[model samples]
Target: MSESLVQAIASNQPELNVEMLEDIEIEKLGEGNAATTKEKENEKSKKRKTGAPAERIALCKYIILDELPFKAAEKEGFKIFVAEICPMFQISSGYTSGGCKREFSVSPRLTDIVGKSIGELLVDVVTQWLLPRLFSCTLDNAAANDVAMRHVHSKLNARNILATNGQYLHQRCVSHIINLVVEGLEDIGMSVIRGREAVKWINASPSRSRSFKDIAKIAKVDTSKFLCMDVPTRWNLTYLMLEAALPYEPAMRLFQTMNPYFASDLKERNHRKMSIGVPTELDWIEVKRMCGFLEQFYNLTHLVFGSHYFTSHQVLMELCDMIGLITDLEEDEDDGFRNMVMRLRLKLGKYWLEETKLNPKMNKILYIAIMLDPDPRQKMKHVEYCLKLVYGSTWANELLE
Candidate 1:
């Protein structure tokens, strides 16, 4: 906050108690980690005589979209908004008001994702929301808000930071879009069936769905002429393109009939790695699946992302719906914990886009949350992708130009 604002508040309060004013928690501008360094050093100094080797820090990472504006940087005509990720291991200490306030125990790691998503959101708020009223471009630079934003960016850079949602946070970001596509699959009547029982298969034992995939292959051959037509089946983006061309009703029925877990046996299912959010993190396979769902969207065919269902508009509505249904997702635990963590993740995924900064147009249509692989070694892969989209090719280099 600016000093002027602080003074205004202090003067308003007759008592002028500095401590009480200081106690109010401001949103994280990345200061949470300063306290942990001294403690770490003290431990090392004490342990030197006993001389056990110090513990190693294991780094965790994940990949977000390899680019921006869905890939091309400012070619989409937007500014870059960067975020620094700060993870806080915390503690609580008592205070006069009541009990304790939480304090961070370590420093935050920072990374720059400054690109279309952040820029658009900030611009949207400024232009569509604040500019028309709070400030006018016709006027010159205003005060606090812009200044606060710059300071926040500085703090993020001074501290080593992660993108918001950090590594796991990426999972949350893309899942919002994935969940929308999954729900879109449901829209063309994929959730119901006829004959022996469509609804039954859907509600059937997970194994029952396995039998349906087999049935679909048989049906494919038998109805060879009919199956030859394009169908929209976006279990992922490529599948979605194929599914989009088919007759909706049959395409959906085909989808519901497809078993998502065909390759695995029950033992494999049980052993499928996952983390209980409260207990531990997910295993690599589950993590890969999360990345796979997102990566598929940016692959070969999606050069242009906006469309009927795929457009930022439709994709965003589905996300808002997920947020509205948060209670139902929570109730999923009521069934007792088989894939409960995954299910809960699916639920949280719905809200993931809400975290991204988007223009109202994009915001209303799509939420673009992003997570990045923290290992800087992999950073170049994503950066290369962004460069391709931004510069059109490394040689053209308009961003550089």
Candidate 2:
């Protein structure tokens, strides 16, 4: 009946076609819902695809800022966490993290890194950034840095941007200066050499390390405190090595007694130098003395390198303590120890003593820092006393003047 009605309508109204009638019937029956569902699906797909890039960028930032290892992203636990929170994000590999590090690294061109070039770059940065005031620049003991600092001092002085005509513009790195002082006593005596060789012999192989651990246990020594080898160039590490080895001295002696091969092996390695064979009673005594001497330097180095504390004000007090330490140790009866202390004293004086021609004149800032300190113990009188103890009263008065 509907078909017949449609035919009658088409015949009565020639403009209206059967196809147009079919479309109107389909819309009424809700067959267009399929197209609407497809559109929603497409919108959801677009959102999912776009979310991944943002999540990846966040992951990259997390890795970079937290200083996490590249493999951290690919770990099973991390991947599972990422999947739970962001299913669309794919975890990257270590290689990808390394690539990101390289891309983000900022460094000056290495082709021309001379003092003049360095000064120019620094001036450019200071000008572009428009810093209100330029103060000191701490640098290690390097000839090139000396030249660069002079150039910077001149530039800032010409602009009238520096106080005191840039006299305190070059601050020597205290840690580096300490290193130089300690390094001056590198070859203290054969006792240190034998002690180092003993440690090296113990840590040469896994078998030897385990044997030492077992011996330490038998000697009732704390096995948790393991022996460590020191880098020759790093005095702090050497101090640590000696400190760690002191507790194991009993174990070391017991092992030496049990295994004569220990001394024999070291002797062979040292080409039969009897002095470098094995640590003796005298060697242990000297080592203990050396450890005590180096402790101050180790502590000062840590204090100087602390990032969360203001160390400038404390440097003068610490330097006074160091000078006193060296002075006290200078009276040791042992010729070798006295010689070592003398060498360190000479080196310290070279850099710190006001009367010495080799002294860098930039240490006035240190005195200034101590004078400004709010500590009751660090008043002007105390500074004067410290200077008098280090330099003579005449030089101290001159410095104050």
Candidate 3:
């Protein structure tokens, strides 16, 4: 705060005792005075430790460096590029009657990712664009990223820029890890295959879609919603397909009986083979159950995808909630769901262990974020309790200490 603002505040508080006013004045004057040798040394140490300018120190605390990758299909051959990645930041302006207030902003930086290697490209970006501005980098769990981060640390060490000892420099992307866990679950079982085939067939051609609509009308079922095609890479699309198709189970079954061509088309297009097998009543029930199960994950993903606000601090709590749900579902009466949850639980456990290996500085920053959150006062005691529950007293105590 400026000295003028401090004086104004002190002047407005007439009831302020002489001692309080004197202290405030003294502090303001101290800020205006020249720095002592010891104070200069301490400031330099802090600057080196954080790799941030004194002016930018507060703003860099929660900034994130990420890469948004895209394929350059326009070219003759396949080429991938890290098209753009925006840095997101939040800064508190001043204290209000209610509390402190902050403004959020995003600045996107675009750079060609083609170079000698991915690590070299990343190192160049870090040095030229991020070095002093970035507090940490959030990245997908890929072996390439591990190599890239190691390269970054090596460069930083060579420059004597030991920001958090280059340990807090790497912040694992929770969303990517969760997507992988869900992918693993999908790989193990073809539980959604029947539902996928049913949707794919009905939505394959206009004639088939019209036939399905007519069947829905004849069966006195709702025809407002249509079946949706799902992309293999995004599981959310599959969840959405299942959700949209569940209500049309009766119509679909009747349509399958009425039209034998539902199993195969006379001609195939786009290398898509004819999809066989309509979803049975039992299969529809399973789809509904899987949708219910996946909704939690979908919601959590939406919550953390936010960039304008704090997210890292909530990662642990969300993981805790997910693990708890997985634990409960692992003992489910439905054998299928129980088995799926078992696979998901294993994946979640593996990622959780990897996340726990984050540097102490990164953990400290996340804890500070949680404590500073306006709506929820995540006190240290509560954080410790959660840690203890998840990682046991020994580990939690060590973290707290």
Candidate 4:
């Protein structure tokens, strides 16, 4: 809505549907239902459809750290442990192949006593559990496509990305797996990276089959050793499937090669980036799936992101630019960074209401693309005396498969 209308509502126009926040609603009782209802009503019946699992999922739509597993603070031996958290914790849940909702949580306990904060811990989890799992699977269909993978992984760097699981989760989730190596080479500790690179080269090469035997012999490793595992199963995305993988020389070679700069970079003080303004409702299962998908590509993710050529932030900016959201990319390249609140003034006759379309899918794409915008906090607002022909409210949450 327009700032003027918001101001008016906040001022003397209380009847215009503005209510000041006087209290916090810890219970998610009457919230989001209207968005849900409106979403169901407005979502057009399209030809495209995806998998629909039968299991019940508890989408964390919106949660607070206070609502997490830990209660207040605990008395550990000599100290009282407390959750040092930001103001919000937003997440989501979706059904798996078997109808199970997979929600995720990094080892806050692991990161806590271990020193890092929860957000950092989630990143580490993505490195370990998430990336590893991605390597264990193969991309086959539209559901298992590479382009989709790229969309998901690049989003990791967003501000507040850790707090929610919006549609962005599926964007390039597969590509994120492929990008693992890009992420790893920045740290030089991995000897296995080279071998894995060889595997990737072979898989990605024209003469892959012919070079396979020779590649294994030169690396003194054998891919044949990985026979017992079911190859690329779905859960492999979660477990990282390393247990099923033959840890022989062949497998070792593929897993060892990583970035030297990464280790050194890891030792350096971490520079924190701002959170993206989009809200999410992420789940542990998707996190696990994200982990499984990232395995081999963990180092790659580091590499892609580390390159001075193009940062994750830049990529997202390009996306937003394509949608005409980021104007004048050549001059003020950083305009996408502010909180964008699109102010809408639909001029019409006295008794008529103006209608507008806020397609959820387009909104999602815009939201993800905005993360890459040069500005981290850009938001939009629309102003109207009345929302005509619209569902219920200007703000809504839509669920799609």
Candidate 5:
């Protein structure tokens, strides 16, 4: 096999000649033992014939499952590894691997991305893929998604493929709902805005970042975690930004004292005048309080988005905890904290409360999931207790009925 490979390389590569092949020594296995050379040759021939195709198939599966680049097979190291395992098999080139056709097709859509257009496009894709049935489609909390789901529900119902008449066909994305709830608290005060400005200034350049690290080191703050800037649209990112910056509060203050230019730089960039500036002592205190409040929502969001296990049964319990958190925070002495919790409560009520007209009814699936919990401690009784806590005994009784 090595001899053949050498010959092939010499033939293909203009730089290599037949003379170079003379210096290459090919080792003969099972050379002088009990077995004859003829028997060894026959065994190798049989192995090559039987193992080559299976090895090739396994290689293909590896590439596809790992999402590796097609050019991986063309590398010299890869060819050598293949030779060591299955010497008789010929390694395919990157172009050959890339040329293998996929089982799916891509269709371009030039239409607007509204509900009707999205619904039609989804139906077309489902048909093209020959999907027999779809249990549900999860989407974010967009008004357009509501319309899209309704269109999809009608189309699926016409074909008699829907279970429960498509009642559960539109599964609202839990993470997105959590985002909406957390976003209600985003306007807590100038504290958040100032904190965001601080992070932005620190991360603006390599020199600033290095200087901050030096300050952090001197303050004995953990230099392992770099400051993170938050996107206003994502509450989770904002939570992360605050969480990262909280520990750096000491470092930030020290840096500000050491570098008078820091505050001046922020002030110079403050076109939003009243809204943007360096974080004050009160700002850090408010940020700390906000972090404490946002932590629960951030954790709940993470749990719901987990991929290792089904999280439906866990949803109601976490949401019940959220209700408890909001109710407790409502009594906080800080007026800003209480106001923020009130807003969060209103947002939660819009989606989870039974009587709110914003959502005509709470999704029955959440209740069904909790009832299906296998744990004796977390069965229907626990759900009833939570409901009673939120809606009182009378409303809980009505819901139970």
Candidate 6:
């Protein structure tokens, strides 16, 4: 019947085509209903395809500050603080860019672990609370930490979830190791100690501090930034003290005349009068030189220990640059600087040797981290060569496993 109606329309007969046009309108309405039904089916199919909701698994790095001394908590015992930090993008949609989000798992309000073995306790906390999310752990280079890492590895292995077969379980704290290297330089130590003692005497009395500021003003030195005392354990504070005091040498000399406290304090502190109590002309010169020498370390420490982004790839390169700087300084003419440079070189070289030893599965982790970076990815021939040297020609193949 449809073929006959189409034939009549092709023949150009309007009277016969009128009924055919009405029938065509009825068929179009039915087709529209079928199309709507098909659309509903597609929506249902999509919902079925994504039945179980997708989850974003977050990766994090944990830092453990062992045995933090808090006065309030000290009534019971020392406290250990654990901080879990992760790149913001993984867990936070709003903070998708720039810096990591940090949460303290163990706050200072809690007392330190006692009676039970700390290593075992930490392992339990990590395995139970953080094992699902933690990527790696950073720790200070204390002898106790060596045992703790071993314990962590053993527990992780038992669960068959040890990352990289537990090879990269521990991250060496760069800041602490840098502090150790700075302490090893005896000449810098002497200059810093003298500067520290001078600042301490001035800070001990409000009158002396006020007088020192006035003297600095009279000497045309900028009084906007006041002198800061060095914390005994923090080498960075010593650097800051020397840096701030270097410009105030002339003012410090003039203030020594006005304040008898400076002399008496020095005398009392140095009972035998064995060392330079205050920063003399020579001491200031040494301080200036030490600051210059420490510039590379200061810069690299800030760079590698940044919280905003990953820095594991930069560790090897920065250490290499520092070693090169020390090697160049070794030939310097000054006897004191040469000795200091030698000690720094030796100290840094010890770490460099350990990192590049090409043995022990753990040491290769650093190289692997460098290779994983998109910017320096596979461009580090040194890392590749070391891996090849240690793991044979099939190192790339082995890395896959």
By summed lDDT, the worst window of 10 consecutive residues in model 1 runs over 54-63
Query: Which digits, one per residue and each the tens of the lDDT, describe model 3 over residues 272-349?
Result: 353435566776777787887777788778878998977877776776677777877888897867888888877776
Give Cα-based local distance difference scores for all models.
0.33, 0.80, 0.64, 0.31, 0.77, 0.64
Give the higher-TM-score candidate: 1 or 5.
5
- Number of the top TM-score candidate: 2
Task: Write down the TM-score of every candidate.
Answer: 0.21, 0.68, 0.58, 0.16, 0.63, 0.56
lDDT, candidate 4, 1-401, per-residue tens:
35575666566755444333222222233456766876764442221111112111121211232243221222242122111221121222232455221211244443333333333444465666655332211232222233333333444534334324333343332234333212322221122222222233334334443444454466676344431222222333222333323233343333223323322322342223322211112322233323333342333334345635634333323322222321221233222211110110111111111123443222244233334555535322211111211223543222111
Per-residue lDDT value at 174 in model 3: 72
Clashing residue pairs in candidate 3 are none
Report lDDT (Cα) of residue 371, candidate 1. 15
Q: Write the per-residue lDDT of candidate 5 for residues 264-334, one digit (tens) a residue.
A: 88777653456366888999999998887789888889888988988888888888888888888899898
Find the number of clashing residue pairs for candidate 4: 107
Off by over 4 Å in 4: 1-141, 145-167, 173-401
Q: Candidate 5: TM-score?
A: 0.63
What number of clashing residue pairs does each candidate have, in the order they appear? 29, 0, 0, 107, 0, 0
By TM-score, how accurate is candidate 3?
0.58
Query: Model 6, residue 321: displacement in angstroms?
Result: 2.7
Candidate 2 regions exceeding 4 Å error are 1-113, 271-275, 356-360
Model 6 agreement with the true structure over 244-321: per-residue lDDT tens digits: 778888898888787776866675665235655666787788789787777778877898779999887777666666
Best by lDDT: 2
lDDT of 6: 0.64
